[model samples]
Target: MAQERDVNPWVKMGLELGPVIAFFIGYNRWKDDVFTIAGTDYNGFVLVTAAFIPLMVASTLILWRLSGHLSRMQILTLVLVLVFGGLTVWLNDETFFKMKPTIIYAMFAAILGFGLMRGQSYMAALMGQVMPMQPEGWMILTRRMTWFFAALAVANEAIWRLMSTDAWVNFKTFGLPLALFAFFMLQGGLVRRFGLDNGKG
Candidate 1:
């Protein structure tokens, strides 16, 4: 199991996402127990919300301590979570929690749109670590992904506004991940179009 520690990037993502998953489970399982974190019989869900801030703080400190580096995107994401997540746990409401995905997607859309406007393919620069595509290729990819993120943000808003909380929770559990997988499939063609074969290039 020690080899598991080497995958810090994925671990970091799980750490960051853990609280949100907890919130969904918590509010669904025991909404009344949210404010009862002082006792041993803490609700699994409420317990997670209570630990969200400290867990995030510790996770960040640990990640930085171990890696000695943190990406700007990662930092931005963490800050947003702290802000919105704090509101959620403190307010004992899911509105802030519900808005979290929307904010993140909108931020991504903004970044992509800004990059496209400036004639720089933002997505390429951001994703160049895995595949070093030319600037033009990056631009093309960025433009495509910009619209995609915007659409995702719109969809999140629509779902939250129209559906029951339980439905939204279930969607978060299943729908988003499924959609993301499908999206990566669609972007596969772009990887090929850029003359870089994701299969071997």
Candidate 2:
């Protein structure tokens, strides 16, 4: 097993969220710059999408260097960002970038849901080493997360498709994080009720 490095919670949060924040800043700063790439006229959204890809890669690398390991979810997220972000920049179309979050959420939901169907708890498999829990707790958490991720996917689709670019960007930058914080807060009761003593279950 890889040695687990102790990371400050604030630092972890910063590493995870910094790239998106950077993208938002970069977009707002260059939204009107008449930039052209690959024979396509680029707008704020396209430029931000382009910037996001490299920032995500650099962030993931920093995370791995600091923690000595990258979680599966992190790896999956970076891959999707690169692929979808690349498409968005290359095509100079914002649709691909807008769909990235929905794709990611749906993929996670599907993975967990499939594991549950197979009588396995992927939540435990992914996080169990760090957070040991009873089988029941893992099952409950996995089921909850599967549904939560599905809901997020639907929400992302609705927002990007129905809202303007600025609204969609705001949702991505602020709304998603708030929603996740609320979701985790709501899970506190379940965690307390099911958490094992001695950090092992």
Candidate 3:
């Protein structure tokens, strides 16, 4: 297997986040436009979703090409983007796109839950390369992450179902990422205590 290169953090962040930011920009720029296809009218949301899909695909491919590897989460996220984004465009319904995040989070939660049942920390398996820690720490963090993903799934469902599309877009773009950042920041103590070598890089 080819060894993966250590990607620059800024470049990595850009590749991961560029598509999402583009989607937001595209949606806002053309949200008032109407697209007609096959004698059917599609809203700007659908149009932006179609555009978003390709951006996601391109970003994922570029990330893999640069880093020489794709994490399981990245692969899964790309697959879901293609599947749900394609469905949204094909069916001209935004519901599929809206539900994509929920499904992704829920699936991750389920996978982690299964790992926990088997006395394994799939969270560590997924993240161990960057954050080396004791086995006990991995297990504890894994348990918390499983619940966190579940909560995120629930939050996505609630936001999409009860809020406006604009609101949902904002939540997906900003709220979700912020929540994740906060969650990880809160884990600083765990990263300190159970971290190998006292969390030294």
lDDT (C-alpha, whole model) for all candidates: 0.71, 0.86, 0.93
**Which 10 consecutive positions of candidate 1 have the poorest summed lDDT?**
1-10
- Residue 102's lDDT in candidate 3: 97
lDDT per residue for candidate 2 within 36-55, as digits (tens), equals 66666788778778778888
Return whichever of 1 and 3 wins on lDDT: 3
> For candidate 2, which ten residues in a row score worst on lDDT?
192-201
Ordered list by lDDT, greatest first: 3, 2, 1
lDDT by residue (129-165, candidate 3, tens digit) is: 7989988999999899999999999999998999899
Candidate 3 Cα misplacement greater than 4 A, ranges? 199-201
Alpha-carbon RMSD, candidate 3: 1.9
Q: Against the true structure, whose TM-score is highest?
A: 3
Q: How does model 2 score by TM-score?
A: 0.91
Best by lDDT: 3
TM-score of each: 0.76, 0.91, 0.95
Per residue, candidate 1 scores C-alpha lDDT tens digits across 1-201 of: 122134366777776566557656666777555344444354344345556667767777777766666667768878886888788666665577678778988999998898778878766666687777656677777877788889889988999999876677778767876787788888766677664554444
